[model samples]
Target: MADRFHEGLRSQVAFVTHTRDYRSAEVLPSLARHGFTTTERPHDRETERLLAQFDPDLVVLAIDPRHDDDIALVRQVARACKAQIIVVAPGPHPHGLALALEAGADVCVRDTDGGEMFNAQLGAILRRKTSPIEQEAEDDGPSTITVRDLVLDFDRCQAVRNGESIPLTPTEFKILAYLAKNAGKVVSPVEILRAVQDYTYSEREAQEIVKVYIRRIRRKVELDPAEPSYIVNVRGFGYMLERRSNRRDAVRASEAA
Candidate 1:
């Protein structure tokens, strides 16, 4: 779609369309002007070949509802490449939208909209594509911790809950951050003490001090301090931040609903 304000910058994008109608003509030129090298593919084989060769940053599938095979073609493209996909469907149908999402279309647009809206949607999708890899790298990197809504910003020395700032004392923050970063894995009181404090102490003393600080930190963060959600006592082993259980429960609830 044409965005008059758009300044062309080189970004590779692939378009899969079954027809060469006026609408397609209008859309392709705008994409080219925006610094995209557009290639039109009519079949799945051609689409896959183009994707493998050009290695596009995004794939836009303009589906023709008349062709039932178009849906299958979309699924093929999704499986064959890792590019972020945007599907343009003819109308608003909940089933079709769900199918598109299931087929790995990151975003879907109904053809009822004009070019401006389409351009804006395209821009937003591209932005998401660029950011997610960086986010995933950060998630996979060491020294980062995530538990439910809480995220310990190690570099910033702060804890955040659903984007809201949560204040914590230096000692409390370090202790929680360490536990969360090593989530789902138990760390003994001695190990925690060594990590958070430099002073040498007996294992018994370390266990006692770590327990007290953990309890205090839990009271400040946990929704139900008595029935902890993020951090859990591992009894024989020590303490671990439970993340998988919460995620599993959420998935189960969604499936049930």
Candidate 2:
């Protein structure tokens, strides 16, 4: 496919990938036609050096998420520079995408997502970066909300359940707060996406991406993620979090007696 030259991709591109041959032919030509000045790096080890040398407006990292260290490399790149960051791999792995996002990549795309899709994701992140994420703005409220054993302290930026801290990415924290604020009520993924991302998503894309973050939240907050109690999936709709009733306490007391 011919690259459509968009102003967004026309900015400088720093392409970092472990496998130089993986879709390089396709990626490079598209980037070139888009007017992006490209510099390629095989390893993220000297991400700081590369960023300084290239001074790119966009950083693209192609990696295999199956490798744990590769995920960490995304973190290194994300933290090392202010350039709009994109983590583009050759395939789809929701977990990797989520991890890359949690680590602070501005966007994640498929390596084959030609210049057009690349341009769109870049634009969204560019917009998202300019504004304060919804949760951060809302943090001016009570600062803490405690429900049964689960507590979210916006001031401390922490979520605790059963006395253990449930580590959350900024976006995950926003989703949790929004859901917990309306505990027991179903909230559509579109609502959550708009609130957390500041960008609306199509229904299809909203459902899948929100599910990834919800699953991540469940892993941290639920004792058995296989049967989640914290974030209940509302079939064909959205999600809900059922507040544990005092009935469970009474049952426990009776069993102890």
Candidate 3:
């Protein structure tokens, strides 16, 4: 019965990674047992052509975050196709996970989670993609949210600030749009993950992931990221976005006082 169930999924999965040992010894075997058709590559060389040929249901990326180019690889795969992405990193690195997700990865998995958990995560994502409700949601076209001069264009998955275009990954835009929709309110990291990522993490883990993305967002949006006037931290509570016009005015007022 289990074999039949696995066969029914008929999932086409691919792994793009430089770390071949872990993937070959563990992940690929597990995927095989689950009846998924699989492919593997050491890097994104000729990735577009291969991706188009495979037309996979999911793409797994195993990378070391310290290599700056790994993040770029994720962005490249994201632009290449609509396949859901899962990034597998070596260990418990929250910042790495945040970077992967922000670069358009659908989910980030730590390799320490082992093959069983990895297989389970992939299976869950496949189920969600095949879900009827999820399909309906994807059918809806993009929309826009205007928060003063910060305009979030969901169609293009980018932001425009005072007529200047700022490119953002889909996940980054979601986090920002969530904060904008609830402007002037403090939003906890856990709340943001639940609403945007559709998953829950421990408060500590969520904080680590959300803070990195917030810092990145500030760099792109704030005139002086070091002393931000737009997104403000609420101390031990959470973060809030101040929706006042001309945020520089607030900075000047504080400096004058």
Candidate 4:
């Protein structure tokens, strides 16, 4: 049964399992059926070796509670590898999921529904992996906008302000990058909703979600989030990037004068 499922997977995947019985009985056959390559490793050392060797695009971690510090293991693996991870656990716990997220598990699934839900979740993750946002700027060109000492590198998915890197979630980063790319332009909420979520503006409920994400982004990138200097709300319209500078820039300008 597992073998049949494994052969059908459209994307390349790497499976990691520590338990020998589970690996042989369940994991290997399923992975083979889904057309995913399986790499069985004992524990720490071999797991690390295989991860580096395979350099998998996605990692499916089958974790059991009895194993030695599974959470920590997951954390170590996630930190070391750039691949997106989907963790399968015995049961759902809010605290556990929170810990998993901190450890870098992009998605988590409970084993209650058996392997069926696991397979579905795996497929969903793969679908998302296939489509990534196309950057709106040139790779080597100067950024389209600079706001509050921050340089928006749309092509590279990076934001640097005063030599410090500000981490933004994929959605937050995209929203900011898009606004910055079209700087000095008052982009409407409708336009923002379409660009960021790829949803039609007519769905007002979905568009409202954009505001929530924008507020979260502002907290991270703005100096005074209450009076946002980087992402400015244009009253009834939407948002705009404000041009400001760090104190260091001001001091340097004064010295030059």
Residue-level lDDT of model 4, residues 23-122, one tens digit each, is 3344455555556766755565677777887887667676753444877777778767777676666554544544554455655555654566566555
TM-score of each: 0.49, 0.55, 0.63, 0.50
Q: Look at candidate 4 and tell me the lDDT of residue 189.
A: 68
The superposed Cα distance between candidate 1 and the true structure at residue 55, in angstroms, equals: 1.9
In the range 80-149, model 1's lDDT, one tens digit per residue, is 7766666777764545644654444555565765565567666554443223334445554554467778
List the RMSD of every prediction in angstroms.
18.1, 8.7, 6.3, 10.5
The local lDDT score (0 to 100) that residue 223 gets in candidate 2 is: 74
Q: Candidate 3 local accuracy as lDDT?
A: 0.71
TM-score of 1: 0.49
Please give the ranking of all candidate structures by lDDT, highest first, separated by commas. Answer: 3, 2, 1, 4
Candidate topping lDDT? 3
Q: Which tens-of-lDDT digit does each residue in 1-257 have in candidate 3?
A: 34544556666566455533455566777667656678877774677788888877677778876567888888888888777787888878887887876676777777787776677776655454333334445654446777768888755657899999986655566788888878888889899877776667779779877877787788888888877777777766677777875554533344210
Question: Ten residues in a row with the worst lDDT in model 3?
Answer: 248-257
Kindly list the per-residue Cα lDDT of model 2 for residues 40-93, writing each as its tens digit. 768845766777777776677777665778778877766666666667765556
- Candidate-wise lDDT, in order: 0.63, 0.66, 0.71, 0.59
Q: Return the lDDT, model 3, position 210.
A: 83
Off by over 4 Å in 2: 1-40, 44-86, 89-140, 246-257
Using TM-score as the measure, which candidate wins?
3
Model 4 residue runs over 4 Å out of place are: 1-11, 19-34, 64-68, 131-257
